[model samples]
Target: MTAPDETQAIRLSKRLAADLGCSRREAELYIEGGWVQVDGRLAEEPGLRVRPDQQVQLQSGARAEEAPPVTLLLHKPPGYEAGLGGIEPGAHASRSRGAPEALTLLQPDSLHAEGGPPVRVLQRHFRQLQCHTPLPTEASGLVVYTQDRRMARRLAEDIETLEQECIVQVTGRIADGGLQRLCHGLEFNGRALPPIKVSWQSEQRLRFALKGIRPGQVPAMCAAVGLSVVALKRLRIGRVALAPLAEGQWRYLRPWERF
Candidate 1:
């Protein structure tokens, strides 16, 4: 039997990413973020495994980019949780093995069940994307995933580093240069965020493109501008636009889709 064909276990990492159909960087992120599991045990190192038959999986907190190789141009309503839980416009919260899932600021339904998978399904799949956003857990619009690290990093930087675009409805009379101030005079947590492009779509309707936003910076910027945001929605991320999706819907990214 030649020593059972010399079956050997392999360490996981970039190689594992190719084997598992995720990005190398994502695999590392998953491991570092404590999302790796082997043979029903938490495996911290990507290179630690015993056999091909051993179970490999991810944890809940690490599986945000579930639902396969997807790119959603979500219409992100005002109150849906930005994470795996929430209620407003997206998917419904999937009940845990029995624990009611986790507590979320928004209703626990919008984050999991729409065109996307149930939170439990996502949590069961890949927890691999790095550089997660720390929003209110009730934020909405454009999320991406892939088995390609190169594409993922490019998308991440293009969306977060370049000017991100959004449409907001404001209230109250405008102070002079309020939009101008928000476009260029914004700062958060002491670091200077990137400048933005702001203009009026109509009275009470504003269109903005800002870079280096800190999660909920738009709302904060509105508050600073003394403008009450009656409604806020993300329309684009870099070159990816929300034009094709209806509320609560998602789709796989095209092979030709570039940042």
Candidate 2:
């Protein structure tokens, strides 16, 4: 797949501003304060080019003067694109006009109100928060957006390797041994797929746990096994799960939470 233009040789401060929704001055301040890093190394230069392969991140323990980065876990409902604009390659590129901004889902009341640590809502938290995980426009599930460059880089670089668990609701009957095929007999982009764990969540729902999944891969795998997908929902990504947060609502990723 072709890399997005934004990922190639862009100035670090510009990238930060674009990703975090802050001004260039703010981005410069963050970088100069040693709050920003490129590929795990501290970057003091705002003009540094953020190569496509290099990851950009902010220190988890930034000082009070630095705008605290925020990582949000959103229960993305169908119809909204994950990112501000379609920056990720291969995913859908356009969002319907009048579609709600997924960030709006992050309201004061939506904060995980049960038992976890309480997170403050700040105006800056809503600004420039970039989506790390891009869900298809039709799919509904947990979506992650963050201002911390480090978390963003980690999720983006590890996306293909990180295990994602999805629940797929299907129609039609599965051919005998189809379950086994789903677990082992799939390929994408003309390459044999890595071994995956697939099992029946229920009569019509199939639970898939796999790494290196690409866009539209699940439906293709289902069709290869004589099943038709009716609905699909991602339930987990790495150690994070979509629970407690209801659809169209969002909550903060606690300081202790990873991925």
Candidate 3:
């Protein structure tokens, strides 16, 4: 079999752009969206070199509109890092022997609902995801990863003020005036803590609603009140809640939903 001349081959995006009468970017999106096929096999790389004789066709119902970047809400289980912090850049490397990264749970099989988000689950959606919202490894609950810059920016800039709701389980008796102190009188790192909402949800469970949560802050607060934290789980961030999402599963952020 004679090898096709390399000089005669063209970039798949260029060829598809010409065939579809669309812009180069549009063609690339189509290819990256897994809607383009070459010789009946799905071809996802727009820069792939193709011979003129090779067949390139768009899948049925394929549209040229820009694909919206995806944002995922994951129910992170305890002991997994919300984001792989500095272990390996952009790689889901385990932080330690027993700990794994929550990013590893973003696979198609871990998608929360069968009838998922308004958008289809494409391989491209998983690429370049950024997780600005970090949950404590020792705690569990809602963690966010986004491919959209707007969503990323919103979460980052608003994090300090955005309210976080957590359910903490404890074992021990509270000190005198501890409930009031937990709300507004506690001092952390030599700075007076702001007023917060802390109340008992049940006999052993306490709910905390506050802003500017720090790593270990909840445990520290519990200890300050003479209580020992048995477990901690975040239930909500800003306006988004972690309900209906099982631990180790993820779902797309709805279009109407905001941070």
Candidate 3 lDDT over residue span 1-259, tens digit each: 9987788899999999999899999999899878999999988889999999899999998877777898999998887887643221122344555668788889988898752776877887888998877765667888899999988898778877888888999999999998999999998778889999999999889999998876567778889989998877878988999998998989998988876
Model 1 accuracy (lDDT, Cα): 0.54
* Candidates' C-alpha lDDT: 0.54, 0.76, 0.83
lDDT string, candidate 2, 1-259, tens digits: 9765763588899988887888898888778666887988888778888876778887876542654787888888877766633322124456657766777777667766662534445555676788867776667788888888999899878877778888889998999899998888778779898788999979999998888776567888888888998877778888998998778877778888776
Lowest lDDT sum, 10 consecutive residues, model 3, at: 85-94
Q: Which runs in model 3 stand beyond 4 Å of their true positions?
A: 1-26, 37-43, 47-56, 84-98
* Prediction 1 TM-score vs. true: 0.50
| TM-score of each predicted structure versus truth | 0.50, 0.69, 0.80
Candidate 1: where are CA atoms >4 Å away? 1-78, 83-135, 155-159, 186-194
Error of 2 at 174 (Å): 0.4
Clashing pairs in 2: 20-128, 21-128, 57-149, 57-150
Candidate 1 versus truth, CA RMSD in Å, comes to 12.7
Q: Which one is best on lDDT?
A: 3
Q: Model 3: clashing residue pairs?
A: none
User: Could you tell me which 10 consecutive residues in candidate 1 have the lowest summed lDDT?
Assistant: 99-108
